[model samples]
Target: MIKYIEKLVKKLKTSEKGQGMVEYALIIAFVAAIAIVALNNGLGQAVKDAFTGASNMVTSASNAAGTWATHKDT
Candidate 1:
């Protein structure tokens, strides 16, 4: 049993599968960290503000279009 455990440990240490998985996990963790920092530091607010501005513009344009449609040029 000990020999089998040691063999398994050695195999795991020499395996590329585990290395690849660890590399991918590290990459995911790094990207997640970056995203968290970006969203926490005004990036989130900026995005929200942009969306709000766009919505306001669309609302204004729609109201104007409705008014123009109702008040056709004679």
Candidate 2:
């Protein structure tokens, strides 16, 4: 049993297989953080443009309705 325990301890001390996996995890976390920040900055402008386009369409429709109502008596 003593020899078995010694072999287990030696195996634990010589392990290096997990070091590369930790490095890859850190790099992927950094890239995801950068992408989130970039998306946050651009999202506001995209929403603003969509609202502006909708407002323009509503105004044009309102004007056309008013013109038809005023000229209908002729």
Candidate 3:
């Protein structure tokens, strides 16, 4: 049983086909970790607030334009 396990380990060590895949996986994992940290540290709230402010501005502008359109001749 030990010899079989040793042979498997040796085979894994000698294999090169999966090396690039492992490197890419590591990079993706690292980026995901940074994104998670940024979102947790107020970056997420800032983005939400920015979008909300933009939406409110658009709504106000639209309502103002609609009122002017309806009251143009009055």
Candidate 4:
């Protein structure tokens, strides 16, 4: 039983079959950790605010242009 267990352990240590899966799992875990940290540190809110600001600016510009067109003949 000891020899069998040792052999199995050695085989698992030497095996490369699951190596790719392990690497992918590690990469996914690292990306998730980074995403969590970034979102938790107000980076997510900063991005949202940036987009909202831009949208508001565009809307204001559009409204101004529409008003100018309407008043062009006056």
Query: Which ranges of candidate 3 are over 4 A from the true structure?
Result: 1-14
> lDDT at 57 for candidate 3?
100
Model 1 TM-score?
A: 0.77
RMSD of 4: 2.6
Lowest summed lDDT across 10 adjacent residues in model 3 is found at 65-74
lDDT of 2 by residue, 2-73 (tens): 999999999978988798998999999999998788769997688789999999999999999999999996
How close is each model in CA RMSD to the real structure?
2.1, 7.2, 2.7, 2.6
**Clashing residue pairs, backbone N/CA/C < 3 A, model 2:** none
Tens-place lDDT digits, model 3, residues 1-74:
99999999999899898899999999999999999999999999999999999999999999999999999968
Cα TM-score per model: 0.77, 0.45, 0.71, 0.70
Clashing residue pairs in candidate 1 are: none
Expressed as tens digits, the lDDT of each residue in 1-74 for candidate 4 is: 99999999999999999899999999999999999999999999999999999999999999999999999968
Which structure is stronger by TM-score: 1 or 2? 1
Best by TM-score: 1
Give the distance in Å from residue 13's predicted Cα in candidate 2 to where it truly belongs. 34
Q: Which 10-residue window in model 1 sums to the lowest lDDT?
A: 12-21
Name the lDDT value of residue 38 in candidate 2: 74
Candidate 1, residue 32: Cα displacement in angstroms equals 1.6
User: Which residue runs does candidate 1 get wrong by more than 4 Å?
Assistant: none
Q: How far off is residue 60 in model 1, in Å?
A: 0.7
Which residue window of length 10 is worst by lDDT in model 4?
A: 65-74
